[model samples]
Target: MASPAAAAPSTRSVRLQIPRAHRGLRDGIEAWLEAERDQIVLWAPVAFGGGIAIWFLLPDARGWLSAMLSCVAVGLGGMATGTGGRLARILAIGGLLCAGGIALVWWRADRVAAPVLARPVVVAFTATVERVEPLAARDRVRLTLLPDAGAGLPRRVRVNLATGDAPVGAGEGARIGLRARLMPPPAAAVPGAHDFARVAWFAGIGATGRGFAPVTVIAPGAGQGGLRTRLTAHITSRLDGSRGGIAAALATGDEGAIASVDSEAMRRAGLAHLLSVSGLHITAVVAATMLLVLRLLALSPWLAIRLRLPLVAAAAGALAAIGYTLLTGSQVPTIRSCVASLLVLVALTMGREAMTLRLVAAGAMIVLLAWPEALVGASFQLSFAAIAAIVALHEHPAVQDWFAPREEGWGLRLVRGLGSLLLTGLVVEAALMPIAVYHFHKAGLYGAAANIVAIPLTTFVVMPLDAAALLFDTVGLGAPLWWLTDLALQILLGLAHLVANAPGASVALPSMPVAAFGTMVAGGLWLALWRTRVRWFGWLPLAVGASWAVLTPAPDLLVTGDGRHLAVRVDGGLALLRDRAGDYTRTMLAENGGIDGEPALLADQAAARCTPDACAVDVRAEGRAWRVLATRSGYPVAWRTLVAACRSADIVVSERRLPRGCIPRWLKLDAAMLRTTGGVAVTFAGGRVRTVRTPGDRHPWLVPATVMPFRVARFDGGREVRRRALQRRRD
Candidate 1:
């Protein structure tokens, strides 16, 4: 038998091995739990289903469906890997097969439906105005058509019309006939430009129309009887003459009352968002309403308890927010914010943790389901991105540390406020830069600075006063509020002018290449979602964008088409020709092609300048050099010598073509034409030519065959050299 000591050592080793095995098993179980935690549940699955449905319903939906289904397959694979053994293999194979089946069904449905869906047709119909606004120079109106007019497409149409003599209101229904052109909304304007068509499609618009010519309102009757419309009209009508117009515009999205010039000034000043009812505005209004209601409830403890005061107040605030959203015409972005806020509120009321990511996803799902096209809109993209970024930033450990421990004293508070503003401005500006460049071809370099001053003013002073004015107007004492609003407007306008005038304030950037823009967006998303040092790599796009802006070429020519003057690029120098004597032509020429250099006058007698071989003349160059006949009183010898040197010049460079003299090739006096024979001719109405032709075609060669009226010649080594009168001496 083995010794007792030897047996003891072996038993100890076995016991140690058992504990290690147990520990490994526990670790594996914890990981499995974590993975399960990450899995989609509840609303996530619903959203996933909606995405799948959209993929199935839209054209080219099979690809999108395949991509989404692949994610499911990936999850299954990940699960199987952790399970190991025979069970894992079986699970993987089964999961893949299930995914394949679903994909096949989607594909089959799409193929079958593709032929059955009729290509939308253009037809005349009556439509009710859902939303209307001015875009560029045209009026863009979204209208819902009558359902049973036998137009089997959809209930809505986006109309781009000339804002005619009639003033249109949102709730008004019109009995006007117009042609509806039906087509799929474009994906984007210039690759990365927001796709409005996709947005319109999801909003239930199958067609777009132009004009109110065939469109006439049936009556000024209340079109859609909604609480939102009623509130909008009420607020707008009451705040009509008040400076609270901007406030009402911001609160209710009634921009019609806001003057165009004022609106533009606010935008340039970086206070444009204040005028729109966005997430920030909605949150503020809700918070304010909740506080007021809570304070009232707190005053009566018994009533508060009986009414479930907090919950009741929250519900009221929710209703108010919804009404506000509708009053603001319920734009996709506004509605998205409303839904997102409501989700957060409901989560709070139910005592469930409302994760930022979850709320964002829910909001996205709502928007996509309602208007699948909104996924491509700028307002949708920027609003969501800004919100998501703000949420992420607030959650960041570094940011939390800096802000969580409140600063004491006024000086410290001011420092904190300024720091917060700077950080927020930087993040939002960075987030929106790429999209702004893509759409506008210009980036506000000083936008961060503008926001630093404007955001605080707009939020703290402008919005509050406007809101107060609206409230006061509802009663009858609106004058004070209106005056304050006017003062705020003036301050805003001043800030806009100051910022707009700043050096390098607005830099015109070249439109980004589609691939580059897509890459940048992907990089940005990675930076936001991924937590690592690699996030810094997102700056690569900024670098690339800067380089592109620096390298963009200038336009070849800039013309005003007013027929005042012509600026021609001749031999790398700009030549100015004024049709009439005035400073306008000279000033315009100086600014042509955005060149801000000294004006070199070619026609003014006192400032006339030219190259050694060329001369300036008051008379225009008309006919071909060989055919220009000099007047009898001036340059007779030079004229005879010029005509003798050439015989075939039959062209006339003039403002008006003369019927006499073989009807020569008439070149317009103000036009710049590049002749194949290596010479350029500027002409006048009297058939005068100031031709600059070099010895060879490479240098500027003149072909002479018909006739030359004025010339001076010199013979050097058997080669005849001729110099024509580029200038006409007055008789």
Candidate 2:
């Protein structure tokens, strides 16, 4: 054996020779450098152009200038790094110039239209209806406020109308003039709720209008035109006499035209997405277009050139998709699909392979920067997740063979199709579970099953029939197609109805806090993006979030019916209303607090025990108690009773004016007390007793009691006093 000193020399010798042994590493580094140089030359212009566009779109001048300066810094840094090529320098300079141009345009636009800085004025304006829908029993109409004569008039205003009339169409631009309140557009609800304000901003709507007036239509303005209008009109005509309008809605994002019953059926089945023009619809359209284009090319040798044909077809399809997107008002899901399609078209135009993952990422980046708030929207998150899953599954090697069928056997095709459907369902469901739980507080357990059946039927039978019917209607041959579309719609509705009524169709989850929702979304996104098995770690946060939501405590002080007894939220504790009526109110309170009690018994006991003049109040638990002074006449006697009660009782309350002799401990029940009719509350150090007048007045949800002052309570010395002069007048 060699001595320790000898072994050290041997180890040193091996270390010294290590670099020589791996001489190929140096060559590999050189090769990598060469490849990077080529890549930089290719991507330099694209990156520079994108940066410039970003800088231009920045909302503030300071940001725009800073971004422009960053371009210069990047160029200098490239030069200092000693790897800057002629292409890199040229790209940098081009980027800076583009940024400057963007800034100039922004400045010019800003100067041309100075910000309106006037107090919100009530103005009488006439608007033309663009879209209308029922929102929570009220009509919310989006309209274009037609200006009398102005170069820069606010383009649109949303009107909330209290009309019992039917919904108006986009083509029927009714002139609605009203003296409406105007305000600056509000930020989107829930951070990512659809930014109608931004959409209106793009359309030139600076102010929103409310209320309605009798209106007339001057003439039919330019209705939706081009293929979009034609397609929508065609579908509408075909589905006119159909029992089920869902098919037409599924084919075109026109749920407004769908019957309420069919719409509810689909919603219950969790197949409402079928009616919306989403990723599934867009993909179907794209696939159909591609197949038709390929077949037409194959049939015609004269136009079957390998070059430009595919690109041209893709471009046409993309344009059609974009038109459809606009026709559907460019909802987030539709916009996402269009963006992905456009990316694919660009790749095809450049003779590059279009990868789904890359397209999804690019679409996401674009949407986030353009509408950062969309990150919180359910549609944005779910749409992208579904598309990403489909793309990934489509690329998997195990399923690659299914794409290329050896023989067109019915069984083989059916199996392959089913397999693909299952794959898609599993992937999308897994990806969206966290989001569904977080935002909706409910998960459709059978969503995958419903989608499996409904998606294929929708793509193959319903949409095609609807589209064909629309096409036939344009050429005066729609009578036969109409019947066919109707049959297809009925079948679709039946499928939805069956699935919705299936056992365990959906499960309600507990509501989650906003922070937990954010965490869940972040974790899920991380798992989706991760390339390793460690992705399973995402489940930890999801489980934690679910647990937190499930364990959240219930709220306190749930009062039901008008001036009824409060049902203490404690288990088995029951308080009955002074009035024996108002079961609806009692039930509402019970539901709100998860209270268990017999309302009838409590109400009977309360009514029997408490009289108009003298009421006996019980205190089962040691706490403050309230006494209401009741009398047939004379404020002096009532005031004396109230004063005596206040000595022993924690609080004294009266529906009538305070007696002339009594003084209040606390004068004037504040705005907070007005919210609850449980009588003016007298709170002790331990507990509170509320005294509410019977037959409380009803107020609208928006109106706050802070604007009103209590007329009954008056301060006299250190006590409350009510004048007998007013009491005798009432008697």
Candidate 3:
């Protein structure tokens, strides 16, 4: 009924509304960019780490190189045009940092490239022990051996030696000859699991094996393990068994000495960090050294006035930190903490506050540059997250106001200190939650409370006692100190077991998506780094990430890398198709399914119709039943049985490759197929099976194309080149 002119006005208004909304969004973004000019520098590590992550995701070096080049080109172009505003400049810097990160990690990987073992073979050689690391099994020790150059093997090879047959005390610089069957390092057990082969590759280790023949000591080099070994022996001898193991670990960074049962208890109760020599240990060492040396120097007033006491004391602390780090094996986490502690000493010399987010970022950049591969490691992630969160919380304006010292009674002061400790623990736990969930697939509910007591006990009570024991052992009076250390460790171990036994100590969460993890990291960094009110907006991404992590369903089916083990979801729990799977395999599969316990055997289930050669079962998922038929026998099966299973089942699995006549309705997995995929995880979404394969391509340390250790792809003169098959290394 309205006139055409009235309708034209209404349409015009609607069109104008869109532009107005667009304009508002643009203006808001511009304001945010402007406000964050100073804060954006803090994101350099994030940008750098992003590029490193992308390199790992791509299958080949060319893809990563091409991407890196593209980023550089885009960054340069952006820099040229960034005269417009701070936003443009920020984008340009981000691009360059990302390119730099990718380039650095790629260079590192290439530099560490070594020849991989082509096949399993028995070999005997006299090799020097480069390093000796303790394993969870007390009888086993991991030895890095430098084989003779004529052997045509990689520079370093790791072997797990049994104490029964191997040398009694193998340590650094010892030469030994042994015959062992060596094989290439292995891939993950299932899709989305940790890849030890890739880690081994970056460590310049191409082969791993267990010593089968008795180890013969060919030549014992000069004082192998030296002072560190003697110290470890003294600690362990004073406090034997698990107590000694914990003490030795804290003193010498020999974590493998800890009993597996106690380690698991500590891990589940969230006190495992105490076993690792990292920030807290390094901090205590540096602080105690500085204080003691400063007091001694201050006793002489003449020297105190002549020399800058703080600088002199800081120098002493720096030396102690470096020495302690080396004594403790110079591991990645310990080195990271050492670097940060040294930075604090540097700050002290310059009369500046050291505990800042900037310091954390700077230390990360250094570590990323030196050991770029560590960026993806759990130790790097957890250590950095905890320290960064604490520093951020310490610097918060609100926290500062609430924690300010006031004229109050001892009771009020003690209460305030306890409250502060509780708050810091909560903040650290929250910051580490996403990372823990991503890597471990579980979240410890009482980790904050556990840390409140364990951290102080380890840092204050136990470390000092352990150190005193070491000092007094030279005079043979360390028994008392060692006794005290043992008592404290017993209390610590008791707390670990008690907390681990509590109901809901840790809740298994579904496997996390990479996107969700990245989002959470961005959100956390944003919330921690920025001081403006706008920082509160970071909760949006955090909430989004938490939701995504919670909603991502567990895999319905998992196949092991060796094609011998198959786990399927059934009756709201996981079930192994066979009972032959090892404990490690069973635990990994359960973790993949977000289940707390090992999988039940399918053959033992009441409804599963399984024979000596085959197993057929029905699993309900996404509101429909899926029929899965899998072979049981390793030998050949009846042709008619295979055909029947393939025809009737929704999915089919076989130990041997299927014939053309055997086709399934949905999916099929056989030995031949599994060889290429390494491992496979199948999930149902919207009534469709979604497959996730690991080591998806031949990436240096993954699936072998031929009998060679693995198929490695590389770029040569802008063209993909192939390597001829290698012959036997020891003919």
Candidate 4:
């Protein structure tokens, strides 16, 4: 190097030598970061939810203090928006939010901690009803009970009772006596099934049970039979059949009167949200109240001149929204709507943009701060997702032009409004598809069309008429109103039935992994939250997640928690390992296998060897024929026959343990092994096995068998107490 400066490449020259692809990538990333700079705060709720999810999975919060400290440090590091580059600032704020979430969830858990039922028990007790919820079943009703003070019972318990067995006059806040069979909330029967026990624990419900004997109304005192209960009763009394149930649900949010068939139809048509009294109902009530306020104020010239009409209307709307939220059971969705509505009202009052991503995020943050656990609930997730999507759509420049109001005649305006409704419905259904499938294992394909009709029918016609009926009932001028309400409700039901029964109306999907669900959600948020051209990149991950979900294979074999039931994949669906399974067991097996229809009985399936006590079937798994054997009668099998079958079969499943010589070629699953595992699902695609209870993964809800929270309690059938206790201890 004659001259060091000349020999070495100049810094500018080196920078210029960068590959085109690399430079393009860099430029793209910078643009993305720049676009997302302001949107960082919008992601705060997502980070917080991630922390809550971690707590649910691990349930270990020993390091929460450190997380909190980190949050403080991160906050300090990113105190100013321009403290660092956009990326660094975003990372710092995200870290703070994540840490805050962890701290909040840990603290909330400790605060709400209560003892859960450790075992089944029988007790006769008197309790007061805090609230009542109607079940889908005709004769059954769910009651939230408040146990007597100083009693050796939980502070709160949820129990079911046969309506026919209870006092006919029983309503909210009535003291009742009953002899019930109380049991711990149940765990999942399959590996990925819903965990009732976990839900119960978070909800502070110590036990769940059904009344084994008739319930007596100790004192029909109704300290809680307030307006909601009275309104529900009045609605039901005026309307009969399914109409009454729909009317009551729309008015008071209690769906007990709706028959199972009608409810199922609504679910299949994707109109179940209407009965849930969510944002749609809340907005309708608020908007109506505001319009009425404006007109009434206009009538009074003096008041109109003195008072700010819009401001007064907003205040009245807020009050109406709050009252409606309380009237309609105050479910998670209703509360979320109330929060969002309150935010919008505040914004309007302050002369700010009322509908924006910031408003949605603020509402979500409020809910999460109050009830962090709600983040995991379906209602919360769906509500926020829909609102965010709608707002984002409106924010789009192209969409804005399409939806922009123009000076036009009433006819043109009506057509434009209808077009907007239809388009919005389609967008919402598309956005909600993944979530709906994940939770229900099905998606309503024609939901958009069905909702376009159902929403208007319910919101514009049904609810208004029902309100009018209730208002005019005090003056005996409500019969026509009640009849009009019923007519609209019946039309809505008819639409539900029509849409649900159509061919391919809903598509059943395979059970998807949590990873896929998270991926879809991330992609959706990306597309909806960002305004830059890069937002379309969200589709890449969305497509990947959707493919993953649709391609997930069903388990090849399944065993119940108690090893009393077994199933194997068949040609069309699944074939039961035993024919003597009950309805509940059959339904669980079918659902776990991703089969919409009932499973074929092993006795009925072709090419199956069967007996009263055992059945042998040859099925294809992993592109190979594998013979499976299952015992049905729960009796000790003949050693010679069992050994012969074991030698020939690839898998052997029996209620009793096999002899030492009885070895299957692949696996032997017996009751002794299943007891520890809880339930087992085997997939031959990659020879994977999943269990309901993994070894060493114990929690307060899924306690180990060898370790009892108290004693290894069991129901001793009418045995003498002392003798039974002594026998139990000795055993």
Candidate 5:
């Protein structure tokens, strides 16, 4: 019924609305980018981390050459930037920082790579005990030994001496002589997994092994290591069981003392971080010290007025942080906390408010520059993420309102306090979720709930009582205080157990792709580092990453580095190839494959037909019937079984030498191949086989690949070159 002019106006209105909406969205994005401009400076480190992560992900390509090239590129970029505008200059600066990060990792790796012993050789040597920890479950005492001068050994060596007939005392200054089988630190169990060798390289530990007999005390050296070790030993010796284990772990940095059951419970309940003396413990100690100092100063009017109460409290807090660091062996996390806390104290003395992000960024840079390997460590990632999230949450106006003092009523104050705890716990748990899934392959479903109880208990009751107990112990009056501390810990431990037992306390997740993890990191950083409605755009990448994780495919086969075990995908779970599987194997199976249940019980679940000689299992993939066989070298495996497997099985796992003519058109992982590759993960898709190695030849610790035979492919106007595979060092 409308006229042509009316219809024209309506069409025009729709067209105008489209552009307006688009313009508004564009403006919103730009405004978000412009907001908190200063915080954009923090992206320099993020870019640097990205570069370092890239270096880690890529295979080693002539280490020294790559390092030199990176350095040169950075220098060239810097010089070239002088001729360009602001955008170019910014890009150049980012490049320089990123290149610098890569170079730092290379330099650190080279500096710490001492000559490793080639084989497990029995060596009789006397070394001073720099530090000592006992592993009673394994009937051995691990020692951080400083080899004597001219010992022709690495500066620092960690040796495990068996407590055979006589128990070895971990007394500092004691020079113990023992014959031990020493070998280089073990390699990574799976590719893209934790590299113990790299960790040892950074820690200055060149070798690891266990003694065949008990260690004999030969001489007492000067400056017996740390008083804290003795103190922890005394406390643990008295307490015994899980109580002593948790107590000793809290007091000292020796978490090995904790019982397996208690540790597992804590882990399941997402309370495992409490056992480590990290940022939380350091903050609590410093905070408690500051409060105590402030109260003491307030009690004396003259001192409060004349002494500068805040300065005194800050100084006390700094000293307390330093002492705790020392007591905890000056570990990486403790050192980071100490440095950050010192920064805070310095800010207080200068009368400048230290922004949390600035302090965190500075602290992270310091740790990375000092220990570049920490960038790969889960602890570093989790700790920094939690701190950043807390800072971001605090800056929210709603959070501020919720936390603000309610002068009207005590009930309101109580509600605000409880809300604050809940929010803090939720923030930390949410921030750590991606990291937890990537590293441990599980995100604690009830972690926030667990933390609601654990955080308050840890911050107030346990920490305070433990600190009081420590102070009392130092002066030989700790018994009653220790009892009180024990009671508190018992309650905390019980809570952990109950939470761990709760239904759906934790959810297993497939190993998230590296790309997905990187995306999530970018999203999380964007969200946490800015303050604008547009910052919510970070959720876009986060959601995409989450979707990718949910859809990613898991590996179908896994092999252990030692070639002593194999796990094949079966019936939506992994089936064990061996009669008995180790803890490491089980954990890797569950984490990497997202498989449930126990390893020892998995062999039967596989419905495998076995004899002392060999075992065979049927597999069906993509409408094709397949067979898998497991056999030992010396076993009298029937020829018919091997022949049938070679014909019908898509994959064969065996240590025995196969017949020359009976080779399968499928995949074969023999002992010799496993040795070369260490461990391997395999997947099948689109009727093709894909494999990934555990100790990929590209790692920094692995020997450089030797130039050998190779082939090149040439396409129309391009040429492709094949890089030779790096060989593993055979023991």
Candidate 6:
């Protein structure tokens, strides 16, 4: 045998055996990290955003004392940042900022919330209409109402009014009086679903209900909102046809005018953003206005030569953004886009090249600080994700090469332009993929191709005609322009229908767990905010999150908030237990689990035997069974149903009170239990079942339900009561 020292492998030999790819990757990461050391500061804002998101998901603090503790944490974080090295100081500063952010949101929520009696209360209230949206049904208008003083309402409340005969348009301000039954905002439809109540609380809305009678217009022209309403009405009337609604939506941001079919089509085709007043529309308007102003001023050589043309154009662009914002009713997204544009214009005017990342960060910061609750909403998340991803990836060497311009003849140039559009669409779709799937549980398979075709048509033809139509109407010369707008809209709608109807146009995905979504967000942020090759580490969480989402199991049964509606998974489809075909929530849940079409159409998919008194689902495919029963409290058969359900069903759901004699061994959720849970989702696998509530104590927006007093105590002031007491004492 060889000597022991020679027989053992030398450490040098092991080092020499390392793979070339692994060594190269390690070296690249280190080099990138060293080169981009200073760019680490950009991550601070992302940390601040994390704080906002964390606070938003936290349940309402137990009391003011917890909020005060949050304040103390903020002060401590500030102190830590004061005594540290450069890296340590940066981390401390981010922590301090995060604590401060949490405190700010907590204080804002506490101050803004207005308590409402749980029971319905009828009141005659006078309020200003901050905004109005017409319902798809045409019979109602949803009004964002700001009550006059002493209305005993929050700063804002949404009320549904029956139009009766006075059609409500996009009027932003008109004082009106209404008799309405107001109740606390509705809770989440299912446990862990989006919490509308929390959203309403942060939005300053205390209550919501239908109007008891027709609204009275106390002051028709008192507020500035009527102008927008009139403009929208004029546009809709002039373009009157199938495409008129679409034209109005683009021109006035009155999306309610679009029919349900058209709306769904656009959404499925991934062209929904084009229908809204967003950054793209605002940017287009700004550029066109700037060019027009510059050309007009250049006609006078003295003005053009003496004045800074670029500065003047930037100022004009800012003004155009403001005008567009107002025209679109100053919705949150429109205002946010305006803010971003203004920031860029101001930077340009000051002779500075605005950094795209800085612009995005500033815009996001402003929006989040002003409306912290928006951090939890899908719109805010999706919009920011798109912008941030684009800014982060656009500078990659690979991306630069892909987007490089080429010199070509006219025909070749046309082909190149089309190819560029397709690439852009692909990039945007990729950026938005996670968010779209997490929120909507579906992604358009044909989205990239649809956008490639639709975007150019909308940007070049439809929007330009819409602008011309608006101008013509304003100046009393609109009929022809309106006709042209209508024609362009028809073409857009046809494209939407075609793409939406294509084979494999969209794919349904299972509901992503909250943890998986959060991990993906963190990964995306890590990649976007860092400039080091170390950023490649982000791929780890992203890959893991995607795998988790793909492997997550779907719930076996789902119940609605009121416990009146339910769905059971059978085969691969959901069997709806309710009578109606269009319960929006149920339909959404079904589609999320890859089920489509009406409940009646999917009847054969489930082995459900339902009678008037009870329904039983015998899932032969999975060898599982469940039963549900509903009864009026006074009916004797209600007791029978309960007893039968307790004895025979794997799960029992009772709409009325439980009977006195039944003790159920199976999972049983009653109306009383659902009142607290809001909704419930149950999953069954391998003879075991798990349940999750929709509402939880962890969400900051959720308001704990108050315990109602059993009885009212009062002092008696009646003369007969006093006399009877005195007489009884004397006797």
| Cα displacement (Å) at residue 646, model 3 | 3.0
**Model 5 clashing residue pairs (backbone):** 190-694, 191-694, 627-649
Residues 1-731, candidate 1, lDDT per residue (tens digit)?
98888667676788889868777766765555345333223134233333444443333435555655675676487575774543344445444444543454344433322111123344455555554443321234344554223444345555566446234433445454455554433323111233444344334444454444546565444544355445444554544433435655666676655655565455544556666678877887777778889898889979966787879878978987897787777887799889988997898799887547558767866676555435545677778777767776776789878876574998887888788778977888778777666555545666677888877677778777867876787788977976787788667667876876667665444334445555566566646643455557766865675556445432222222222233433323344543333554444343332333334444443323333222222222233122221111112334343333222233322221222322323432212322221123222334323322222322000111111112212234232222233232222
What's the TM-score of each model vs. the native? Answer: 0.59, 0.59, 0.90, 0.88, 0.85, 0.84
TM-score: model 6 vs. ground truth: 0.84
Model 1 residue runs over 4 Å out of place are: 1-76, 79-155, 158-164, 167-171, 174-196, 206-220, 223-245, 257-265, 304-308, 347-358, 532-731
Candidate 5 deviant stretches above 4 angstroms = 1-34, 62-86, 121-126, 136-139, 146-155, 163-170, 221-225, 474-477, 600-606, 636-644, 655-662, 685-696, 704-731
RMSD of each: 17.3, 12.6, 7.8, 5.2, 10.2, 9.0
CA lDDT, every model vs. true structure = 0.51, 0.53, 0.80, 0.79, 0.72, 0.69
Taking all chains together, the TM-score of candidate 3 against the true structure is 0.90
* Model 5: lDDT of residue 575: 74
Compared with the true structure, what per-residue lDDT tens digits does model 3 show for residues 409-510? 999999998889889989988998898888888777788888889988998999999989888978989888888999999999999999998998988875
- lDDT of each residue in 1-731, candidate 4, tens digit only: 37999888999987778756476775676667887777767888887777676656653334456556666677667655553556556667777787778778777766766666556777777788887765534767788888776555666778888766656546677888777777777777777666787677677777788875578888785642678777776888899877888888888888888987798789889888788888888899999999999999999999988999999999999999999899887888899899989999999999999998988888888889999888777778878878888888888889889879999999998988888788888888888888877876777878888888888888889989999999999999999999898788888989999998998887777567878988898899889887788789999989999999989888888887767788888786788876667877876787778877679988888868898778888887667888888888744567898899899988788777768787889878887777678778888778788888776654545651211122222456445765666676559
Error in Å for residue 495 of model 2: 1.8
- Write down the lDDT that model 5 would get: 0.72
Residue 628 in model 2: shift from native, Å? 18
Evaluate residue 677 in candidate 5 and report its C-alpha lDDT on the 0 to 100 scale.
Answer: 70
Q: Write the per-residue lDDT of candidate 2 for residues 1-731, one digit (tens) a residue.
A: 98888767677787879878665865664554455443333233234334534532354556666776776676566456564545445545555544544444344334333122022444554556555443311223334455343422354455555444222333334544455555545322221122344344344455564553544445444454334444555565556522334554555465555655566567556677777688777777876787777677777677775545676678668877887687776888888888888888788778787765667777866665455435546787778777776776676566677666677889988888887777778777767776765545445666676789788787888777767776776788877877876776677778777876777665544334556765665566545544445557878886776667566433323232122234332223434334443654454343333333234433244422444443323433334333322222223444565567544432333334444445434332222333344323232224433333223322111111111111212235233234454555569
Instruction: Give the alpha carbon lDDT tens digit for every residue of 1-731 in model 5.
Output: 98888767677688878968677765665455556566767777776776677567666656534754675576567567563433444566676777777777877777776666554555777788887766654555677887776655566778776655323454667887766667777776654456677777778777787665656778764432457757666767756677777777777777766777788789889898888888888888898899999998899988877888988899999999999899887887888889989998899889887647878888888888877788888988988898888877886888877697767688877777888878888888888999988888877767777888887887888777776777787788988887887887888889989988888887777677788988888889989877767679899999888889877777667666665667777777777777666776777776777654554433475457766556677766777656666673343446775676677666767665566544666777676666677666666545433334434445656652112112212223222211111111111
Total colliding residue pairs, candidate 2: 11
Better of 2 and 4 by TM-score: 4
- Give residue 301's error in model 6 in angstroms: 0.7
Q: Rank the candidate models, highest lDDT first.
A: 3, 4, 5, 6, 2, 1
Task: Between candidates 4 and 6, name the one with more favorable lDDT.
Answer: 4
- Scored against the true structure, residue 684 in model 3 reaches a CA lDDT of 60
